[model samples]
Target: MLKKGQFKNAVKMNNIEKYFGHTAALKGVNFGVGANEVVGLVGDNGAGKSTLIKIITGVFPPTNGEIYIRDKKVSLRNYNVKQAYKLGIEAVYQDKSLGEKQDLWRNFFIGRQITDRLGFIKVREEKEIARKIMFDMIGFRGVGISAESKANKLSGGERQGIAIGRAMYFDADLIILDEPTSALSLKEVQKVLNFVRKIKESGKACIYISHILSDVYEISDKLIILDRGKVVATIKKSEVTLKKLSEFMLKYAHAK
Candidate 1:
């Protein structure tokens, strides 16, 4: 149960810390994404961005911290990626996570397939669902692409759409996108941004991590700046312009 005046957050990490032998990857960081909020997590390399995300996604347990999902605390002692998924937290990486050699339908259900009691894969049902996800849920309109098409035939942005669509189909409450728009054409970047908008429209929370200040500013409701394993600032989009945000980040990039 939530406290009297506490706002409901999709995910919250309190005093989170992680260490690698003598090195501290994160230090007493308080991070969160509100229900249906899009949070831009911006930081330079080695700023503990990936480390923080890995902990949230249960790649590894934080050395110290508390994780709460919708006011309920999670036990970190046995937390894993599968457990994180069960908690409705999913991470979409820069890789887009598609099988190059597999068809779209196959890629969508790679590890979690639809099966009958006899253990037979429901091939046709999976294909139909994939079709709905492509054309309906995600508005994926890749030319010459269909459920039968190999994933390698899609462009970078199309791949991201597929990954995001899969996350939505699986009912993720909080989707953490790690450098989602890296190394893409201008048009392709726009494609990924549109998909993110879809996530917002569906009323799901998102933590969008990116180095592209303009794109991050465009989609995020609020921005969290992390420096040296601690949060330096949390700026609302209404409070800062893209140019100003870039300058602010540049100052941190050069800080000794």
Candidate 2:
């Protein structure tokens, strides 16, 4: 149960720290994602962005600090891969996480297959759900994709769209996207950005981890800049422009 009168942040980490032997990956990182905000996590390689996200996804627990989902504190000892899903935290990593040869429906329902009393997979219902999600939730109005559409046929951005759409359909409250727009054409990048907007529209929060500053600027309400495993800047979009953000990143990085 939530504590009385507490604010319900979508995801909150307080005094988070992670260390690998003597190497410190994160140092007392404090962050939060609001219930309907898009916060971009940006930094150069080895800036601890990935480490922070890994902790968020329950891939690893932080060595110290607290994690709260919607104002309720959760113990790291009981947080696992299954618990991550149960708590409505989902991650769409850079890999796009789809089987190349599998059709869209199969990819959507790969592991958590809906089974009947006879222990058989429900084929038609899954297909219909996948189709609705692609067209409605994902806004896939371009080249027609049916249940039989193979994953190999979609573009990088489209693959991301489907993966994100699947997350939304599962009613995930917080979705973490890792470099989702990497290596895509300008048009495709826009489509993926639109999908991120869709996520926000559905009253969900996101941690967008990316190297593309322009897309990050375009989509995120706030930017959290990290340098040397510490947060250097957390500025709203209204407070900083793309050029200024780029300059800030470089300036703080050089200070390290």
Candidate 3:
């Protein structure tokens, strides 16, 4: 649970707009995510969900809008991928980018690592961190495979675990998961959803993007529905029904 003041407003966008050669992708979309909250971003295909994610993650600049982190309005002009990481905002795309040929520890520390005084990669320290993240933080109790098992040898759930473990290892404030369980089995999906819940318990906000309304309802605390580049409604999970949410999406599409 997020203690009072544990997580500030991780990200906020006001009157955000985006255009692709005259095609309006996002029109004044306004939303925000707080620390340790799981907010679902749901919409049909071409509903501007991807565009909004891109802008929020600094993949692209909003043509017109203001973004704030921890209540400070800041320009995102040169804040690229590196800057996003520095802000503790990490994104895990649908593909679960892991090297199938590499072992678990190697994949976990693919980009970030600690160096020894001699300027050499500290293998022992890296493995120790990976072990702690996988077993302690993530609760993965699988067969004690030598942090040397190839990613392909693991199940889909395990690969998903690796991706999530990496994000949490970096202590990301807001984690964005794009269709995380799209290709997993029912049981695997359940495992991943449990992990998402654990993420919230660890006091990190997650933006779960998916078309599966049922999954979103099960895992998210709030729902933000986007249609044709506009926010139709943002509602608390307790105050919404599947039928009502479906209706909102349909109505928004028609209005567009």
Q: Report the lDDT tens digits of candidate 2 across residue range 1-256.
A: 5456434688899999999999999998999898788999998888999899888888999999899987789899998767888888899965548999999899988888888999899999999999899887788876666778899988788888878988998888889988877778889889889999999898889999888888899999999988888887889999998998888777655533
lDDT of each: 0.88, 0.86, 0.84
- Tell me which residue pairs clash in candidate 3: none
Model 3 agreement with the true structure over 141-182: per-residue lDDT tens digits: 668565777888877877888889998988888888888888
Cα lDDT of candidate 3 equals 0.84
Q: Quick one: ranking by lDDT, best first?
A: 1, 2, 3
lDDT of 1: 0.88
Can you write out model 1's per-residue Cα lDDT over 1-256, one digit (the tens) per residue?
Answer: 7567444898899999899998998999998889889999998888999999899898999999899887689988878898899888889876647889999899988888999999999999999999998789888787788999898888888888888988999888889889887877999899889888888999899999998888999999999999988899999999999888998999789545
Candidates in order, TM-scores: namely 0.94, 0.93, 0.92
Best by lDDT: 1
Collision count for each candidate, in order: 0, 0, 0
RMSD of each: 2.7, 2.6, 2.6
